[model samples]
Target: MGIGQSGSKFAISDLGFVSGGSKRRDLGLNQLILAEIGPIKGDIRRPVSCALIRLLQDPDVAVRLASCRSLCFLIGDCNVSEEDFNEFLPTCWSACFRLMEELQEFDSKVQILNLISVSMEHAGEKIVPFAKHLTDFFQKMWEESTGESLLQIQLLAALRNFVGSLGYQSPICYDMVLPILQKGIDINNPDELNLLEDSVLLWEATLAHAPSLVPQLLDFFPYLVAIMERSFDHLQVAISIIEDYIIFAGAEFLNRHASSLAKLLDGIIGNVSDKGLLSTLPIIDVLVQVLKF
Candidate 1:
């Protein structure tokens, strides 16, 4: 067995086709850990995909969750050839459909969170419609203040990220995300504040990846600005997201939403110290560029 960098817990040899081999069955936690550390090299795309597909079907929840997480990460790293991914897509989508159906039955918010995360991260455009349903479920769950459900919050963020990343490539998804966002912004429960905060962060993250969403931004920002004005604790995060919006979405984004964007910036700048204002100089330069153009 090939030893991994840290030690002998797992090795390159462990990732091969025969997952039930002595090492995989004996020492490994699950197919996830095995697929992660195994030495399944470049040409083994189909085999690796098949192995992950099987692992994704494992009866154990933890095993299946781990497999989903690993598969998402692996797809990013493998430099998966297009033809190979085309072959891989059907199987990947099938698992997503199955897992999404399963997630509907999940009582554990954390498991559901991880499921949403990996599904969004790996399933890409294929999972957008389901993500809409999942986000709606989260919206209802957000109302019941069952303590701070961090996983649910983060998964909502991830779902937003996935929708942003996929963009108009999935227009049906576009129609779905905004309504969920509207619901969170309108509802007021002190305990649900963090959920709202996460919702705003999700919106900002979406803006970062999908600049095209800029045109529709005014629909959301006014409510966020009002919330920031009233809340001392969440003000900084709100301002940070606006700054990120300025940077990533660029001047064109600001130009399209100019009047409203400026109003929001004024609100944010008004809350900051002089040092914060000074730090905004570069953003000013960008604004200047947009004006010149």
Candidate 2:
């Protein structure tokens, strides 16, 4: 009997054979059908998770990608309990990183990232313990790439989701994450707004979680100021970051930097035409709030 048929009992090891040959199409079909059957409960959940974990390492890229989708369905769509996912989390995590390292295809890496995003959503802060490992993975990826590639942009999005999941108290916070954010700011492409937006959101989340990082961000003050000269989208994010920094760092840090900030804002304001002023009012409000501190 086929694996998806009612009352059929198949060994998890059999999945290896099915995932190997031309029969792989059948395996994919089975996984989708099983996913649609609702959650795999009681006696079967562990073995099914283990089988999917093994399939994630399948030599066929298609199988690996399908396995990732199936895993998302099982974990997120099916509402698998956190405790159940924990049983196979290490194995699944290892497989994800391994695929990230070994896979040459961009789409495959994106599949892995999607799996991670969904997993983090379902697992919540329970996924925080793996933050360092993910940070190291992304750090390596960042060092190797030019940081403007589509893959890198997608990676930034994934990093934002990961950091947002872990919040500020995560062990990977300052040292590991700051460098990546710096690289993100280095990408000055007007077309890559998503990357910039995600980077800014991550920065805001970081400050919200640990306001102590505000001083560290002061080093980037000039860069953020420079960003205000970019397009409106870029300027908006820069203003948001500056507002967060002022609010979190308190009056003392602002006082120390006030002179330089005032000088920068003067130059920026002097350059703004009447039309620009209309759009820049929100930023001006933020500056007013900062000055009051």
Candidate 3:
């Protein structure tokens, strides 16, 4: 029996499977800890956590995933300190990045990403203190995993949540995002066929939650014109983006992109279906009202 400061008992025999166990046993132990050892006080909990963290590098992919899920719950509910949790982040981050590289199953990879998200949710604003580390990890993950569309999409969605959580501190990572955002929005790119839609959504997410539009972001306005020209596949999303630009960048946006914007609006009005027109017209009114045209 493993004993803790509060006289809590964790059966050591159960955790012995952690060192030489089948995937199923490892999975069982993880759930066992959360159910049984959740209130385990004192240093007794650390060895169980270490077992799970080491299992993160296990040969069995199932074990790795189960181990990660357990760690998230342990630090979230077990008597773990924020300082220890912060120290644990590097191990967790590296394990996740390695798993992302190794795991072929789509669902497994998503579980890994969502596990990070769950950690963020449990930690709440406490995560803000590690923005630099989090963004560094995000940049590396993106750089190391190019051309993997599903991974790219999942990571962007996760990163968008991070941006929203980071709130005012989000733009610290904009330098990493700018190129991806630019590449995703370029309708001419062959890969954009898969990435464009999510990329547009990410753009809107960034714009909506961002504290202020940096100059590079304002420059993204013309890409919306490009998107409008190709197709109104993202009509309402595109319209909403334009409204944000007009509201935020004001006269400078109009002066910089007026002619092309006018031409794009003219084509949109001429070509958009009645349904699409319903969405496009008000933004046009806003544009005219803003410019006093």
- Per-prediction backbone clash count: 1, 0, 0
Q: Evaluate residue 26 in candidate 3 and report its C-alpha lDDT on the 0 to 100 scale.
A: 62
Quote the lDDT for 167 in model 1.
59
The estimated TM-scores of all candidates read 0.62, 0.73, 0.71
Please list the Cα RMSD from the true structure of every candidate, rounded to 1 decimal place: 6.1, 5.3, 5.9
Worst 10 residues of 3 by lDDT: 1-10
lDDT by residue for model 1 over 1-293, one digit each (tens)?
22244465644456555666443542253444445555435656655566666766666656566666656555665555555554555555555546655554444445435544554555556554455554555555554424545655665676575666465553445455665566556436543565787776666556555545444554566676567556645655565556655655565557655676677668658877786666556657766765675
Cα error, residue 125 of model 3, in Å, equals: 4.6
At residue 17, what lDDT does model 2 achieve?
A: 36
The predicted structure with the larger TM-score, 2 or 3, is 2
Q: Please, what are the lDDT tens digits per residue for candidate 3 over residues 1-293?
A: 22333354435555553467565556667777656544645665666666777788887777788887777667666757655465566677778878877877777877888878766655556678777877887787778668788888887787767776766767877878778888888888777888888899989878876777798898888788888888878988888887787777778888887887788778778998888778877777787788784
lDDT of each: 0.57, 0.66, 0.75
Q: Which runs of model 1 end up more than 4 angstroms from their true locations?
A: 1-39, 58-66, 69-86, 103-151, 168-171, 186-191, 209-216, 231-267, 282-293
Considering lDDT, which of the candidate structures 1 and 3 is the better prediction for this target? 3
Provide the clash count, candidate 3: 0
